[model samples]
Target: MKHVLAIGAALVLAAGVANAEEECLEVGSPVGAFYVADVTGPSAGTKLCYRCKFKDRPVVSIFAREVNDQVAGLVKQVDGVVGQNQDQKMAAFVVLLTDEPESAEGQLKTVAEKHGIQNTPLTTFDGVAGPASYKLPKDADVTVMMWVDGQLKVNESLKFGELSDSKVSAVLGDTEKILN
Candidate 1:
């Protein structure tokens, strides 16, 4: 009876450990690739793969279908985070996932100018596949994703008017922890 009880307890402990291991994998699944024009860069019209652009630094990506106050605030918030952490190798990308990406270019440029976003890049992709590659939902107004050292560290989906400073800070803090 003692032997059977010990074996049963060990099996339960092993199961717990296995579940914990799988939890990490579930969050860090690989993202697909897509290309976009870097509207804010010196070579403004040049196109590049979204993933390859920020593979080296910790990336904060905000995927929004439309630019609302929430999206603007979140982008500015993340731009500040990246600014403060410039020495730590950080980057932010605002990905506008719209049907008519070209038409939104002027508006995105205006938003970037308004926010004085120096650290983050403001841009848009061609199709829905861009956000889909990041595993973002269609209805979600903003999805904030962070990747550090080529690993997807944080993936947060926020609705309009839902982002707060504390939440953005926590994500930045968590990614910083990964670096250390």
Candidate 2:
């Protein structure tokens, strides 16, 4: 029974490792520019490349398939962080990846207003796959990438139902890695 339990534990651990390794954009990788239609923020209704705008600044980019309560809460928290770190030129944006960009824009706008998300722009990509360069995993419901000087410092991928409060806090904490 003990040997059997050990094998089961090893399998579970291996599965977790595999999932972690599947995250989009490895650390230290260069982040390229990608355009998304800005639903809310300074450039509302315009398609723009946030990467180009925030060049060399510490940035947190979130790509999510759907907007849920958890995602809204995460965005709100990230917005607050961005507001507090303006002196550091820390920036962040949320990209909603959907097949229907038009409807996604409305949903993003609603989330921004409801959550008072002033610092983070809520944007939408054309499809659920996200930008071709991103190579976002099909199983990933949300992918958060933080970079400084255009080099990625942190990359986290969470599947549906995986974005808990603790996970949000962990992601926020990792922002320090790029802020320097």
Candidate 3:
């Protein structure tokens, strides 16, 4: 009886892990248009659709619930990548999901300036749940979706406390998938 119970528990745990690893946006899905308030981008102080603006270009879109050090680090690295890939028209943006978009705007600006983030735009979506179409999981603290020529190539979701240094490196490496 004990052995059976242990096996059942292990199977349950493995199933949970598998579900978490599943991509939020299935690979190869068409990237859709969604408008966010551009806080620190070329179109600052306006609501715009980055997906529309960067159509058919390689893009790295990050949605984060909060701007912590790890999230900031990821954005900074992505900013560098965008700058390097300008010739390829690679673009990236960070969308902060919050109920209080007014308050989040200031913090987004600070993070951009502090990190000297010049290439990627830091924008805000006016809800914690994010765009209805994206279907961002409530438990996901950070979700990264990359696309090339309007088709998603990578979708990675990281829960709170899961965005470690190695994970950031792995995410940056995924940029190559889209860039190519």
Tell me, by lDDT, which candidate is best.
Answer: 3
Candidates sorted by lDDT, best first:
3, 2, 1
Scanning candidate 1 in windows of ten residues, the lowest lDDT window is 20-29
Candidate 2 residue lDDT tens string, 107-150: 88889999999999999999899988776888889999899999
Candidate 1 lDDT over 1-180, as tens digits, reads 999999999999999888655433234766556778778855478887757866757777777878876678778877888888878878778888877878888998888898787777888887754544465655567777777766777777766756667766665566663354
lDDT of 1 at 16: 89
The lDDT values for all models are 0.73, 0.91, 0.92
Model 1's alpha-carbon lDDT is 0.73
Candidate 1 TM-score versus the reference: 0.76
Q: Estimate each model's TM-score.
A: 0.76, 0.87, 0.87
- Which stretches in model 3 have alpha-carbon errors above 4 Å? 1-23
**Per-candidate clashes, comma-separated:** 0, 0, 0
Q: Give a tens-digit lDDT track for model 3, residues 17-134.
A: 8886562668888888999999999999999999999999999999999998889999999999999999999999999999999998889999999999999999999999998777
Compared with the true structure, the alpha-carbon lDDT of candidate 2 equals: 0.91
Clashing pairs in 3: none
Q: Give the Cα error of residue 33 in candidate 2, in Å.
A: 0.8
